[model samples]
Target: MKLYDFPLSGHAHRAHLFLSLIDVDFELVAVDLASGEHKKPPFLALNPFGQVPVLEDDGFIVPDSIAIMVYVAKKYGKTDWLPEDPQQAAQIQRWLSVAAGQIAYGPCAARLVTVFGADFNANEVIARAHSILTLIDAELANRDWLVTNRATIADIALYSYIVQAPEGNVDISFYHDVAKWLRQIEALPGFVPFPTSKAGLRAIS
Candidate 1:
């Protein structure tokens, strides 16, 4: 299996973390997002949308972070990553949706605007981001992980951006529950840190 990804991308990091947690042996193909390599011809052939974290297993290509997580968990990981019960699966899906929707809009989008200098209404986005964070903080006030008693793809999907919220100038100090949750995720076995600098990003690239 081959994973084409940009290290700094949280979405890509989710897949990488999942593979590591499952002890899957695969090739890491760095996509140079800094040079617009993801949009270039050869890379676009892998994913028409030109996104990172494209998983190629035996010539089968899977795009999107959620899809990759599901594939890996179902194919390689323990059943805990993806439960069998319909209610349990729906609970996991709820958090995954939160990661894709509110979390993306808040921490992820804010980070891109601040770090990559992307043109976006920071004030408006930050407002939305804080609302999401506050909601998450409250939800996590009495829980450790997102949806399950233990770690799951739902936690992995949301951890990257939420943990790095400080880098985007979104203060996480008030969210003590989130801070604690971040620590818990980090303590998980096979945990990998998200890229924090241009050099680290280049190394992953």
Candidate 2:
């Protein structure tokens, strides 16, 4: 498999991280977002939306980072990342939705403003970051994993942006449970961290 990736994208990080966790041997093809290579014909042939983290397994192309995680897990990882129970499956889907919506609009959008100079309302995104973080913090208060006894795709789905959120001026210092939860993910085997930018509201100890 060849993973077309951009180092700075948290979306890309999720795919890369999960592949590593599953011990899949794949090649990395760096996509130059700076030069708009993703929007070009060759890349667009892989994903119409021109997104990075597109996985090419043989001739099969899978777009979207979260989708890549799901595909890899279903084909290779199985019960390790996804479970059999209907309730657990539903819970995982819930967090994946949060990752796509709240986390994307909140921490991810906020970081985009600083890291990529994206035009977004920093105050609004940061506030949304906190609102979502508070909920995640509460949920994590009694558990290490997001939806199960061990780590799942749901945890991996939310891991990158939430951990890097402080870089977008979203302070995470007050979310004690969230902070501890971040540490737990870091301690996992085969864990890969998202690159932290120097900008944003870093948590103060």
Candidate 3:
């Protein structure tokens, strides 16, 4: 298996983290986003959207991080990470949608503004980040994981961006349960951290 990754991308990190946690042996192919490599023809063939963390297992391709996680879980028969129950699957899917929607426009967009200089209203995105985080904090107040008793793709989907949210100037200190949840993920076996940017360091300081 091969994963096309960019080190600084939380989206990419999500795929990488899940694969590592499952002990899947996959080769990492670095995509040089700095040099417009992701926008080029070769990479574009893998994902027309020009995104990183596209998985290539044999000749089959899986694009998007959440899609990659689902593919890996299903393909590898690691149902523990992704259960087969209908209601459980639906709940996990709900958080996955949050990860793509709120989490994207919230924490992800905020980080883009700081780390990549993307043109986005910092205040708006940071506010959105806090709003969703507030909900997540409450949801996690009585549980160790998001969906089931154990960690699932739901937790993995939300992990990357929330942990690095401070980089986007969204203060996470007040969310006590959220902070503890981040540590729980970090303590997982074969866990890999998302690389912190200089902007993230400054924001936390």
lDDT scores in order = 0.85, 0.90, 0.95
Candidate 1 lDDT over 1-205, as tens digits, reads 9999899898999899888887889899999998999999998898999998899999999999889999988887478989888998998999999989988888888788767787778777677778998988898989888777998898899898887776666777888998999899888888889977432122233
Tens-place lDDT digits, model 3, residues 9-126? 9999999999999998999999999999999999999999999989999999999999999999999998899999999999999999999999999999999999999999999999
Cα RMSD for predicted model 2: 1.7
Error of 2 at 18 (Å): 0.5
**TM-score winner between candidates 2 and 3:** 3
Q: Whose TM-score is higher: candidate 1's or candidate 2's? A: 2
Q: Candidate 3: give the clashing pairs.
A: none
Kindly report which residue stretches of model 3 are placed more than 4 angstroms away from their true locations once superposed.
200-204
Q: How many clashes show up in model 2?
A: 2
What lDDT score goes with residue 118 in model 3? 95
**After superposition, which runs of candidate 2 have C-alpha atoms over 4 Å from their true positions?**
202-205
Report how far off residue 21 is in candidate 3 (Å). Answer: 0.2
Per-residue lDDT tens digits for candidate 2, residues 84-182, read 789999999999999999999999999999888999998999899999999999999899889989889999999899888878988788899988888
For each candidate in turn, the TM-score is 0.93, 0.96, 0.98
Clashes of each: 0, 2, 0
Give the number of the best model, judged by TM-score.
3
TM-score between model 1 and native: 0.93
